[model samples]
Target: MLEDLLLQGAQPNYADNIRAIAARWEALIPPARLGDLESGDLQAGIVSILESGEVTDDVILTIAGDLASLSWWRGPPLRDDHRARLNALTRARLTRLADSLEMAPRKLPRSQLRRSHVLLVGNLLDPLHSPSGGAIDYAAALASDTAVSRVEIVHSGEVLPAMRTYIEARLGGFPASRGVALVSTRDNPDFLADILSRGPCTFHVWCEPALSPAISLVSRLGPTLMFTCADEAPVQFADVYWYFQSEAHIEKVWKAHAAPQEFIDRYVRILALPSPEPRPLEPMSRASIGLPEDAFVIATVGNRLGVEMDEAYITGIELALRSQPKAVWMVVGGLPDYLLGAFEQVLGDRFLHVPFSRELDRLMTTVDLFANPFRAGGGNSANIAVGAGAAVLSLSRGDVSSLVPDSFIASDPEEYFRYLGFLMDSPELLAAVKAEQGQHNARMRDQGLFLKEIQGLVRLAADRYEARGCGAPLSTTVFAPLTRLAQAG
Candidate 1:
């Protein structure tokens, strides 16, 4: 079946398969770096395996499992018994593969790089899963705009240089004809340096860990802007970008991460969009849900990255269920397997663990309230979905619940219970809140303010280019309105 699928031109899960294979074939060097193994330097191990006719999912998994079973230690030297076992096995396997491979090296262009008016630098290297929904929305709108000429995005995540080069070369054919191409983080410093050397504008949209480095680098480079979600002490630089802070909490950098007062004075804008047609309520089918109909349905969505288990989330659900004993907790973004036993021991039958599904709209509509008991991660956790009219309950701290009204902040279990009680007891209040939330969400969709913000940033970058005489050409049409606004003064 799998072979037939492959023959039909289905994309193989190549990278994931390679990682496992590398771990198994740990021959003194990292298996991942095996692509560097030189049989006269013409062919890499990964290339050899892929080109080999005998390749199958089962074969690869078996090979990787065998390799993994033999090793315990990581890094360069092999002193321990486990390391020796892994190293000996790995070398033998690679030698066998090298003897079998008859193909010669293929030469390719380094990268068919293009330049863009907007250079967006992201810390996320994995193209498939970097830059969250918000970032992608911003990128799509900026690139799609008829006014803007070009956009180049780069990404990296444990990917090989050959793969990175290949993807970037393919990116040369991406849309946005007038714009220049910018580099995403491709793990190759030479590639990054090349773009920086050639490009006129750069904007680093950073999340948490990226904040400090982004700030430092932008300051050093002289023509860069750092936009971050971190709330630490702000670094003085050319400009800072912030979002509309909800009344729930405050950050230290609110005042610090700022552009010059002159820049602020230079532009003023207003936004108003036509009302969108209303969407109707989706019907709830109880049997479709596993839990009892009377049960309080607590739902949460997350990536499962942070250290804290969002036990406070468990507590929130428990509290709600206490008020209504039949309550069942439906969780998306599956919990860690290790913690599953513990969660079962505690929450027992109440916990319903479900893998993260793309059909979130249906799930959100089905749940009583969308709970985001996040202790970590950047940006407003549930804002986008909640804006789409998914009833949300989240932490008052940080960006997650910021846009939520004061009435929505659940500092303690008791406060949460009261709110939950109020929600259940008063259908009118629930309907009104959902309606208001829907309106706010509609505003978000209509404004496309983030795109305009990026445009503004691009203009700032262009002015910097002009000052430096970089002459990196940009779209005059996009910024024409701003120019007019200035001249009208």
Candidate 2:
């Protein structure tokens, strides 16, 4: 029924049809079955609607939100063509929305005013979720900085009891004068805008579908930075764009979006946030996790292992384990039933599946090698594995895994497998890799240095904004220095 409505495109009752399709989609698809649907048909349907030229902004927003949700829940598309088309269409709609709005000229901050406060806007600020972890870490880092006076997080979701407690504990670790607060507006864009307007602070926007309504407003408020999280293309309205992937990847996204060269040169910046500090954990033994103490443990950790785990990754693990009788596979994250069944059928007693846990640090202590699959995400987990003193082996791809040292990154799947075999066969080589990883982590985890870099960037942005002249159109000229600064970092 949904497909039929979508295929019909703009009908006499197009709005009603769209609403009905949304209702049915929500009713039929639960969270676990997000990946079960055939996205090709859905993508085609969405494209049809987009090209029909009769869709309203509200319906366009709905389609954009749905696409984002699918991307997040189902992982990145295996192929880029569909995603590219969808992004282009979505970008066009958003551009139209922005142009249609009669937005007031952006107000620049007073030169004498110190840029001490920062407002982080996002869909959810839950500390437990893997996607929100980077935002939380960024907030924590800002709070810890002496120069920053306050950190205000405006989120549009529920702050559950557990999440609030965790946030309190995490942010409370900083100085008492830092003044960190989480405000829940429950999807109220006007209220969110009011909060932003009330202060002269820098805004950091985390990319999420729920925050779609506020994007136009937020972009015009002071010096706004968009953290794309390596999931979507950078929204054009942001003054500064932050991404976890390499600069090359940023260029590719901008080119795909057909962004002007000047805009790309000025707004795009790589995320240079400090690596997370290793959390202290109680000693965990192999027996505690139901693994053999004598077996060599090779583990992979991620939040969405079901989406990330392909046949090749699973089969590689199976072959590796079969070749070495003493090898064991420990997967620490959520997995679909099919994947869980495959591991169970192949490895049986040798397979250890641990659900997403707070004790990942402890689990890493028991592992001999951290095997990272070739996927777009999982940089955070890979970094955690590195910080925990475990040797990480991953492909030399962009995303967070690029943070891994060059020596340990595999150029291809064959090299990845060969490296895995070599590490498993040689304990000394693995130990050396772990030592090098420790040195890399030490450099990356320098909070003081990282904080200084952030402060400098903020000042640069402020300077550029001021140079644009009062009530004048935003200039691309001032952004050149930022490009140099980002490259240097």
Q: What TM-score would candidate 2 get against the native?
A: 0.81
Writing each residue's lDDT as its tens digit, candidate 2 over 1-489 gives 444433232222134544565575555444333333334466655555544555555555566566554444553442355555555455444544443545455556544224445555555546546546656667787787665666777776776676667666667687756767776666564565566455667766654453264554444445656666543455445566655456676677667655446446555443355445656766688788788889989999876566566778878888999888999999987776667787898779889898767767777888888888777667767777777778888876656555666776887888888899999999899899999987876676777766666665566656655555321322223233333322322
lDDT of 1 by residue, 1-489 (tens): 222211121112232443454444544333444444433221224334532434443343344333332121111111233322322233223223322333222221112111243334444333323243333334455555655554545433454454345344434344646453535454565554555564433444443232222333332333444443323222223333434443122232232323223223222222211121234546445457666676656666665422234456556666676676666777766455456566677878888776655555555565666666544232333553564455666555545544555556677656766677677566688677777766665655563665566556655644553353332111121122323322322
Stretches > 4 Å off in candidate 1: 1-116, 119-133, 158-175, 180-188, 196-199, 208-215, 218-222, 230-238, 246-286, 292-295, 309-313, 337-339, 345-348, 374-381, 411-414, 457-489
Name the best candidate (by TM-score).
Answer: 2
RMSD to true structure for each model, in Å: 16.7, 7.5
TM-score of each: 0.56, 0.81
